[model samples]
Target: MKKCLKKLELKIYHVVKGEKIDGVHAGVYGDVTGIWGDVTGIEGDVTGIRGDVTGIWGNVSGIRGGVTGIRGGVSGIRGDVTGIYGDVSGIEGDVTGICGDVTGIEGYVSGIYGDVSGIEGDVTGICGDVSGIEGYVSGIRGDVNDAKLTDNERLSGIDVSQLIKN
Candidate 1:
């Protein structure tokens, strides 16, 4: 019986041992498992994660634990989705994304469709509140402390800090 058709083709599919799969697109299939996993799919997104993934289409992202994807966007810190469309910035804990947008200092998010800036911390997003004073924002929009003081006041008005202090 040819070893039962190679054990029915390894149980119909789902073979990714040792784990590291990347960016699969066009037509899509199934069976994604994980251990030290990293997956990236484009167009027809399929992502399954135990740890570490970067997806596209459906969007996933992660870190410190592992998982990252974009185009639909996801982000994380304690692990799972590290910001692209759904932006996650980190320091403490509590991160959520479903239209994805979060920024951090202390951390706590229930909803984000975009824009929730950071400085002190307390984000409940629907686009607003751009922070300052230890601000390092992620995704959705911009401001990042007035774009780093307008690029250091446009290179210190061309004086260039007295030619770098001579």
Candidate 2:
């Protein structure tokens, strides 16, 4: 019985039991659940621990939005899907959509998967075993845990970033 924000022009949203779809587009979080479309904008932590999700066409999981959690455990971005794991983080326009502990030494994980937080969660994973910060940094700033580019915890406007979490 969740509702989307009209300001974001969100067209769809589906939340099953034990899940939280808190954002524009169509965000679904729960066990054995999946999102197969453009999830352009999301809000707070889309934690879906022990769940399953597939962002078919984009990284709307945290595109302009902000999210953190495990895949199948967390959010689902566009082409940069966070893959899957026990936890995810950050909000950069990178590949793998800013993850935390998703071992992928095989592909070009343009995004990051270290200990970085979502400018929100102090709960970092992976590479953060040292200082709790994003360990990936190439071209894009990769969110280094900077608390300046965060969006909102709730929908209030059309700009996706406007709803990006803390």
Candidate 1, TM-score vs. the true structure? 0.18
Alpha-carbon lDDT, every model: 0.37, 0.39
lDDT of 2 by residue, 1-166 (tens): 9998676555544533544555444543444434454545445675534443434453343333333643433344323334343333543443334544433433222345444445422433335223233333223323444333224312333443332444
- The estimated TM-scores of all candidates read 0.18, 0.17
Whole-model alpha-carbon lDDT for candidate 1:
0.37
Candidate 1 Cα misplacement greater than 4 A, ranges: 1-43, 53-83, 91-166
- Poorest stretch of ten by lDDT in candidate 1: 137-146
The per-residue C-alpha lDDT of model 1 at residue 64 equals 34
Candidate 2 lDDT for residue 162: 38
